[model samples]
Target: MMMIELLKPDYIFESSWEVCNKVGGIYTVLSTRAKTLQDAFPDKIFFIGPDVWSGKENPLFSEDENCLKDWCAYARESDGLKIRVGRWNIPGSPITILVDFTPFYAQKNDIYGQAWCDFQVDSLHAYGDYDEASMFAYAAGKVVESFYRHCLSKKDRVVYHANEWMTGLGALYLRKHVPEIATIFTTHATSIGRSIAGNNKPLYDYLFAYNGDQMAGELNMQSKHSIEKQTAHHVDCFTTVSEITNNECRELLDKSADVVLMNGFEDDFVPKGNTFVARRKKARQAMLNLANKLLGTKLTDETLIVGTSGRYEFKNKGINVYLESLNRLTRDKNLKRDVLAFINVPGWVGDPREDLIARLKSKEQFTTPLEVPFITHWLHNMNHDQVLDMLKYLNMSNAPESKVKVIFVPCYLDGNDGIWNMHYYDLILGYDLSVYPSYYEPWGYTPLESIAFHVPTVTTDLAGFGLWVNSLKGRFSELADGVKVIHRTDYNYSEVADVIKDTVSDFSALSAAEIKKIRKNAAAIAEKALWKHFIQYYYEAYDIALRNAEKRLAL
Candidate 1:
């Protein structure tokens, strides 16, 4: 085996779905990874993304008025795209560029515009049809092409790393024009999986229906499967967030990625010791209060507080599966433990069908005035007219148990809702067990973050981290009892409920000595899986790309 030296590229361009504008795990990866990239290859790494408009003027770009104008003009005239270039001065390193192509983004009907919008919408809070998204993607593609052209002439060996299908277009564009340039494509999650999980559609119908040519022409109509296929086929070297996504690429796109680079955590930010304990205690107390108000019974310390938190879509994030498990657990007569599930799923109340169903079932509910108001308010906001229809529909099915108090915290919480929401750390520390059964997770950071916080996690095999965990099962099994990996495919509602019941029961069975040991082991595992260790992989990936490019040059 050859130990490759850290030969830094003359210039490195990283285009991610989220850079300054963060909507998901990619944002955290880009933001935290920047420092490491800079430290390893100072003044060489450049990050490019759409210049999302901010209410306040950016000081970074404001300082470089003339250079920014010159770059913009050059990009427009030479590259044939409207581009805004902003620079961020990284301490002890090269400047990071924030690429703004809002003008191109505004032209949603175009090919590049649609692509940009599709990527940004995944991170943006608001939701709309695909016209805006299609235009966004098209504009993004144009802007990326312009940026690549602008940076290509610079005297360093150019290394381009594009994240997800959204930015993969840039690498594809480069490959067509400059085949010698080192291009690496990273698929966070496969489009096929995401679409099937998100859109309640059959896999075959979604995957085979739309091809790249067809998708490039139509904005929102093309399936995610097509976008992923295009990404894999075009990039020079392909990388995925986890083994799961790698497998997905092989299965769906029939193209295997070169590497599996798992996502990682920043340890310094995670709350621990007194801080973590205090927050957990506060969350427990809040849950107890909510339970008392709902079931009219004070929750005891012995009560197992099973927590599940994520963005509020029931189908994709596995909220429906979670609810079914909870329903099954409540029906278990043999189960001895008093279990209470605290659901921190945001955007649930906004869903019409689910909200209507919840409201209808509440009529026979035993919840108190305080609890009722909160639940009803959430329901009303979600769908006012449909709620009445839901009440009528629930007359047929059994009412949800009052014991399993499902408290809906509809808004985004920061340190106030059971735990601090400092991106990853705060959210992970809030629960004893974090449930993430995502149907389409490119690379889940929640499981890793949960383990880091000494909080146990249960994630589906569909997730990237879950696949990684399964690979390290022997190591994980030895580390702690805190984390539990469940194969969602193996179990239905009842089986999942049994597993949840057993896990909670086993957690209760643990002695104080046992719990302390589990926490220590979890911390150890987290240290080994930190972002610092993962940063090395990025350099290695670049090395691979460069070596291949060099070989091509020699030939």
Candidate 2:
């Protein structure tokens, strides 16, 4: 078949569950990339998402009745869609539609029936988030349909992009109803692939052996996987964030992406020069003060603060591997500096420790460890918490004599967690290193954000970002190269842990000049991953979708 001519989009309608909501890595991907797209297309790009806040204020959304007043009115009076027109309070402040899908829940069965008929989507085994997300997506589709019919013409070159399995229903809805509009579907991570890895199964080693439909049945993921699989097949263009996920899509979804839209980020949030130095100094002081009071250990300002943070996925996010590596580092005799490793993953946090709070406020110093000095916040299920359990299993007591100490922060650093009253970005600047030895990461924003903050990190070959770094460097990447990409597999847990231990220990021994150079190198790598560079892949997707849409319309 002859390749279709590439086309530029006059307007773009992108939808994701995380558009204005700060959910997972998708928020970072969308928010950071928004500026680039906005600059390129001016006021032609719009984002659509679910408004789950239910009347309470969301800091991320700045509502403006004037932004899309006409469409908002038409959507309500004509199409009966409940939506709030606003600008997402990010860098570009892109125009957005926050749909209230509450009313759509009443017609859930009808919507599901239509989906089954139109796209052969199987919602028979639907449960949990399947209904809720589908309703939101279905409402979004109506919102877009109303807008396209109200404002756009058939001659307009437009692209309707939906993200993740959560928005698959919307993409399929558009394909069936508005075939004139080009459509793109991006699966950030395959539902079945995530289920396979989350269940502690070997995904990569046995990827070919595992049948997606069979595994979906066995794992009770028929609904989510079905929508994802069908949407990937039905959309004009199917894309993923990275090569790792593209491979997963081919094997699990049985369709390779037309293009791999590698998640890129900007550094407008990062401070520079003397301001950065001062902020880092202040951040380090705050962390040290908290540690000194909570653990009753006289940790100096010179302590190497290394941390890892994300959703509390013990194995998937490699929290287990990270903790095991920290345990090994504590025993390494070659370590020349005090390393303060922080497990920053949030859990079922109950509240901040009252005694720790008192100590943070007081100038009075103490030499005795507080009760459960290892964790900053109290978990709802203290005895059953996985991080605490892992600490106990590893015999990590955070003893004052040990050169390496671990602190588990089981709360989101959203400026008011009682302790560490700063945003994650503000506080994380003080860290010397970040590690994400993920067992299964489609495209890790943790390490990307880490390096963007100029903190060199150790990640695994399994992560999409790690593989990208390897491609940039060619040789085996090391901490000196701004990233250390450790080779990891289902069975190489011990080797990955040992490599992390040795790398961190060696890092602690690096001279000040060498460390500064490594930090510079890391930031340079981040520059290469900016949206200015990665936005081309998105254009490629738009081209494919537009060309395919034309062919379908002709057919």
Candidate 3:
């Protein structure tokens, strides 16, 4: 096949479920990469997302009525579109349009019917968040269609890009309504692949055997898988985040990605020089103070602060494996340093530790351990929580005698989680090491973020980022070299845990100068994963989408 000539889009409109909503990894993907796009396109690039932050103040969105006032008013009066145009509060402050998708719920059946009619999208076996996501996606599509019709001309080469299965409805809608506009669909992780992994099935091993539609029916993921699979086949250019997920897209979605658009991050959020040093110092002090008050043991600056943070998925995020490894570390008598391992996964936290707070206020460090000192915040279901249960099972009381202290921070550290009063990045800066031994991660952002903060991390080969790291190093990466890409198989939970234990032990034994060099190497690896380096993949996707669209239109 002869290569099609590449083309650039005059206008780009990207849509995702997490555009202004800081829900998950997609938020990081779109927000961080926005500046790079903004630099090239200026105001020509726009983001469309669901308006979930109506009554509450969304700190991430800075609303600007002047952005598309005439068009906004026209869309409202003429098309019944309710949207807020603004700038996302990231590096570039790219133009964002938040659509109020509430009204679409009344016409859900009609919308789904139209989708089925136009694109043969299967909503027959729909369940769970399918309706909600579809509605929002439909609304986003309506927003894009309205904008394009009112503002853009046929001569303008426009691209409508939708991210993930949650936003596939919008892409399908745009393709149906606006045939002239090129469409790009990027699935960060295929729904069926995640479902299979989340359900404790061996996805990677049996990836070839499981039919996408059959697994969708089996796992009760029919709706999401249907739309995702169809969108991949229909889009002008289909892409995934990494080579790992590109394989998943091929096997599970039954469509090979035109381009593998690897996720890239920006370092604009990170502090620098004196500010970085000061923040690190502050974070360490805060952590030590809390640990001292909770454990009744005076922790020093030399204490190794280790952490694992993400969504509280016990199996998938490798929180269970992390705990098991920490337990193994706790049993080791050769452990020289006191390890403060933080489980920063968000949960249903009740309140801050009252006793710890009182001690901090009174400047009275307790010589006796507080009740449930292993956790920073009080959880709603104290006895039922998995982390707490695991802690009890392992007898990790965070006592004075224990060399390893595990602290569960069961809340989001959004600068006001009551106990820490520090943002995640601010507090994570103090960590000596981070670990994300994920079993089913598409692209592990936690490990990437840790390395970006110059903290060496241990991730699994199951992670997309881990695979990318392996590609760079030409072998399984080690913590000594900044990233430990442990080969994690479905049945090797214990093996993975043991590897992590050994890695942490080795890292603990490293001299200060050695650790410094490792941290620098970690940051160096992070530099290569930056948007500046990885944005070219997205350009390739755009080029393919445009060329394909041109070919389709000519036909």
Candidate 4:
């Protein structure tokens, strides 16, 4: 049952949003999976990210100033980039560093402008700006470059595994300077697909016609195609979170990667059996109350509540698509099932509200009761204007009868409500079915997390998880009705409706016994896919890189 001892890596350098800092799914991947790497590689694995400077206003860093300063100096002198390295006394962990290089901030700003500056500031804020996407990638690259330079001078035989485009620049920089050093680039999600999805434009038009390259250049970041092309041509090896991303890179960037390492979930974090039963009961009750209050309907135990939650980006994360599909499903008399859609998307200040208005308009046309809550934050740090604008849009739109309620929970609930819950992994373990119709997902962690909860998940072929799920469908089907992969080839309203209708219809007929069987199968599959099994992939990748370096040395 120990499926992870297959590949062992020496000196695995994982640069991601995780470890001490977190931004999105990339953070989850690194932090949740770090212990597994440490267990497999011992002190050989190094977790690297920007030494986020958060000590000024916070008491957390005030207590550790002296140590932070000393470590910062050592990191700077050692790496030559105002860097800082420190270790948390966690067991079986690598030397974690909160790198501080504010001195270099101006230089980066001169190159990347205020966008980068805004992103850096947002990182310190309680609620991060997901749209300020470019800064972390550039900063992470700088960290990697500095780390690689420091390691090289010490004659370290290391395999540099850079996560996403943020750290891909480090691998590229190292390859140019030290070709013998092994380097791998992992693109969790492509910039091109994200832009297209978010902007509601065609990928080709977004890349070539629209001024994406020009805009990115102004920010000192590479266009999606350019980054993929450069990483593919230069790095010792190129990997992606999912096979879908791999194919996208190959087709879109005209370059091939060496591997497609599917993303995974932490088995230890997921609640199981009786523990999950209690949590599920609470979540179900909370959801029902909210649904009844908003939709004006008493949801029965048999009412199917299809849940979807993530960072609230309208087009790209498929929020708009999901809403449109719900509108259509509710309108279809034949498909008129007592289904409640729990959308757990938190509103961001700069995020577009126009899409929300459009969805509200469509929901007005629906006859079946719909309950939609647009969650907002009341905290002082939140953008007041954006919240007001969202409220304004909602007020101006035609309100459906209380049957279709749009409740805005403005306070932060730490996963108590099924919607806008951070601890969705806990909630999903109790879910009958989870839906992820992402227009762009590098390697989605939700589907895998759902699988771990023994919940059948619906993901798109565009996601990295979808690719892996498709690969393991036969194996998983034997155990239970594993993950269902939907094709996201079109983004038109009609097309999205068809996909959602098909998915809901297929899921509706599942017998409770069948669902239980599938849940068991999903858990078994997830057990094998845990970090324990694949942390070695990092080590093995490093070994390949080091071996390649040695062969080059011989030549």
Identify the candidate with maximal TM-score: 2
Per-residue lDDT of model 3, residues 1-555, tens digit only: 998666788999999989889888898999889999999999999999889999889999999989999999999999998888999988899999999998999998898888889888989999888888889999988888888889988899999999999989988888888888899999988898988898889988888888988999998888899899989999999999888888888888889999888889899878999999999999999998988888788989999999999988899899999999999998876677889999999998898888778877767757888887888888889989999999899877776787888888999899998888989999998999999999988888899999999999999898999999999999988887899999998899999999988888888899999999999999999999999999988888889898899899999
- Relative to the true structure, candidate 3 reaches a TM of 0.97
**Tens-place lDDT digits, model 4, residues 423-463:** 55554554566777887777777777777777777777667
Q: In model 2, which regions exceed 4 Å deviation?
A: 1-5
- Those runs of model 4 whose alpha carbons end farther than 4 Å from true positions after fitting are 1-10, 56-73, 76-84, 87-93, 106-156, 176-180, 203-228, 293-297, 332-337, 349-422, 474-480, 491-496, 505-511, 551-555
Q: What is the C-alpha RMSD of each candidate to the true structure, in Å?
A: 7.0, 1.5, 1.6, 8.3
Ranking by TM-score: 2, 3, 1, 4
- As for lDDT, the candidate ahead, 3 or 4, is 3
Name the candidate that leads on lDDT: 2
Ranking 2 against 3 by lDDT, winner: 2
N/CA/C clash count, model 4? 8
Worst 10 residues of 3 by lDDT: 357-366
CA deviation > 4 Å runs, candidate 3: 1-5
Give all candidates' CA lDDT scores. 0.58, 0.92, 0.90, 0.57
C-alpha lDDT of residue 308 in model 4: 72
What lDDT is reached at residue 379 by model 4? 31
